[model samples]
Target chain A: MENKVLMKGNEAIAEAAIRAGCRHYFGYPITPQTELAAYMAKRMPKINGTFLQAESEIAAINMVYGVAGTGKRVMTSSSSPGISLKQEGISYIAGSDLPCLIVNVQRGGPGLGGIQPSQSDYFQATKGGGHGDYHLIVLAPSSVQEMADLTALGFDLADKYRMPAMLLADGTIGQMMEPVVLAEEKEISKVNKPWAVTGTEMKREHNIINSLYLAPDELEQKNFERYEKYKVVEENEARYESFMMEDAEYCVVAFGIAARVSKNAVVAARKQGIKVGLIRPITLWPFPKKAIADAASKVKGFLSVELSTGQMIEDIKLAENCKVPVELCCRVGGMIMSPDEVLGSIKKLMGGAK
Target chain B: MTTEILIAGFGGQGILFAGKFLANKGLLEGRNLSWLPSYGPEMRGGTANCSVVLSDDPIGSPIVTNPDVLIVMNLPSLDKYENAVKTGGTIFVDSTLIKRKVNRTDVNVCYIPATALAQQNDMPTLANMIMIGKVIGECQVVKMDGMEDAVNKIVSARHAALKEINLKALKIGNDYKE
Candidate 1:
């Protein structure tokens, strides 16, 4: 029987990761997502897993990098500002094709912005956050349940693609309490980590894991291989949700908390006869462009609603290629837009009682 | 049907815990539900609130822009959210903390001296629990059996010593016919 147990989103991530066969964790405390680190610190000792609160996010992410190089399912989570510090490490992980999970329970940003929930990291998440030309498989989770579900899926996808995977959640989803069914403890035998580094003690073909390929041709070949894997990821992993779009002329496109808010606005607008729907992108990197482009063909316009002022709307407009009138409704600096606010934007777009 | 509620109060008021109980009840009843709370600096000395969405269909947004119900344990919450409740929604005010009326006739308003009632039960910490009882009593959004199961699970996991008090708080709420 699926029983309800109230748990914070941060706690959910820790519990979920552990259940997903992650016995290694490294993180630094940051507002909105600190509870996750704290929970792991307390629980990892009991589970015989290693949990380390690094001096900084960069250090933590590098810690993830070192562990991941050996192929142990590992994770490191932080808020927006701290996530920025980990960009270098993330780029290294991407370049090395290391499989790891990075949870960014996003807060308002640009610089130590407030610690409120904000979906401002749309571009950072989708555009291969760090420098370099590689991309991380980014998944945006809307609920605490997804906080668990996606963390598990992230590990699977990371292993499947041999790349870094991210859970792009907002601070609200991190801090909230919700009933999440703890996934069954995974069997020890199920941990598939043939790619791990357990002390080169294989005594068979010395395992040399190094990112430094001084030979130009060899580095080029490795880059091409990683690119091919990314190509596969993009082609197969585009995920999104469409609501009431079959008969609707106007729709809102959003993700994460913004998607949740827009969904209500669309539902409420529909009640007023405005024929509205919502398109929520689940995977932002592979970006459900076909869905949004297809939506452009069916709908008169798309309203890009988010917690950041016009950041993700850029992607929607780019995807639609101006085929449809793509308007934007947004909130920034940790402020959340109300349903009334969203509905007002939708109504005005539909030429309703604005 | 989907029932959306926003429970707001101070951090120590157990507003989040009560919201969790309601969301848990919905889950126990096999309903789709979520509970989300304020984060970061707003969580410090500021008013903390949680949005609880209980729906028959899979919940679209855990974040309710305009809640169908608003339960305020303090005055700041009432002032901040009073104008945002749906026209036909319900507003429950803790008269022990909030003195002003919501002043909107479109919404059903209930005045429960929640803190006083908890004090009457000899445990001030049960104020939020009492409020939870009253909310479930007034709305009856979840089955009584579901609520019982939820309360037993939550109180036992949360504060084992206060489990009996929380159960009694629910009983007082269940017994409130009005």
Candidate 2:
């Protein structure tokens, strides 16, 4: 389709959203992710789409909520601190069952940590950042191409489930540039907004978009219904990639940029006859528990590589049912772990020292 | 084959742009590639750098600790990254800006007066492209024919005339004797 183009990951996500029929983008500027909003600001006008830089991240997510309720494709993006501001809005979006996209190009963290690449927000993203008994459909992109592919996928998933979807990316993936073959533009006409609050004139009754339920039983029923949908999502939406698992003694479990580095470590280890493989989770919310479990049954041990103090390790342990020994090799506070370091960890798992 | 490259220089020296050009060239060759920059404060007139990976197979990591090739424009970059180049790897230093000799005898070192060449050729602020040209020519990381097309796509339409100058700079580095 002559669609291959060299672009930064953040810019690709913005372009992909446009192609995915997302005509509205409301975001406050933040490092590592500012390019995405900037691209939308420049291109949205020409395409007759809406791109508004809100006063704050909170306002931006609410803007997404408003546009999404009208059954239009809308999205907002932020970095770590800014994402925290949008959490309340995101929770409300989930509670109201509005379909939208939220992109979190994470940097170092607790509070304005640093402007370097980090995956510390793994828990915040997959465990529902805002709160309540809800889960976000989280998709993590390892490369610039995946950054684009997953943005379109996030929109599709959000629409299909009537829930908010997130593209969980780190600073490295957000700022990096690579070749990408973009997706075909989706026809906005096909997106049905029948339940939207687009004003019911004389044809039907009023459509109210509200999350507040005063009655206890009504709220309980709504929660049950949402959980039912979540179960369906978990069953059908688990996405992952398994690399060189056949006849391997141990496995490395990682996601996003960490997974990218872990793959190099695995490749290097294989060259030395270490028998190490990699299991990458593309969908962080569904968490790809089965992939890890299958590998756990065959492999002797597992190593969790991350850019944090090791949050995803808990998930790996639970997924593996704590059957195999799972160790962590990580670098925290926006620091990236080198391939050699990860390779050393894999070698240790193989019961040897390099 | 896989080529992991690290390009570093001062903030205004076009280090990121050099990485981008090579990355685009790699893409044009239908190879898997990734370009990751060291963003934030390090880019605030300090030592800015980026990692570029080009491979026949899918790239595992966009970041590299020991690069197969290292391109440095300033003295600080050379000092910081000289030891990071792998044994038998190539290190391209900007002789115009750096006067000190390479400390390592194990790796291949190419000292090109890129800044001086750019200043002398009436094309200032093109040392990065010159180093890129030299690297591509020396390392054979990507084809030299892909340079012009990559420049055309990267440079804005308003600066279309710069394409010719960029190609000329690239040729200077590619055809360098030393």
Docking class of 2: high
DockQ of 2: 0.87
Query: Candidate 1 falls in which docking quality class?
Result: medium
**Model 1's TM-score against the true structure:** 0.91
Query: Which predicted model would earn the best DockQ?
Result: 2
lDDT of 1 by residue, A1-354 (tens): 676667888899989999998999999888889898998999899989999988889899999999998888899999999888999999988888788999999988788888889998888887877987788989998778888988898998988888899999998788776668888978633546665667656566655556778899998998888888888888899989888998889879988888877877888888888888888988888888888888888888888899887888888888889887778888998888877788988877776312
Per-residue lDDT of A243-289 in model 2, one digit per residue for the tens?
A: 99998889899999999989888988889988888889999998999
Residue pairs that clash (backbone atoms under 3 angstroms), model 1: A70-A196, A70-A197
Give Cα-based local distance difference scores for all models: 0.84, 0.91
TM-score of chain A of each: 0.95, 0.97
lDDT of 1 at A317: 86
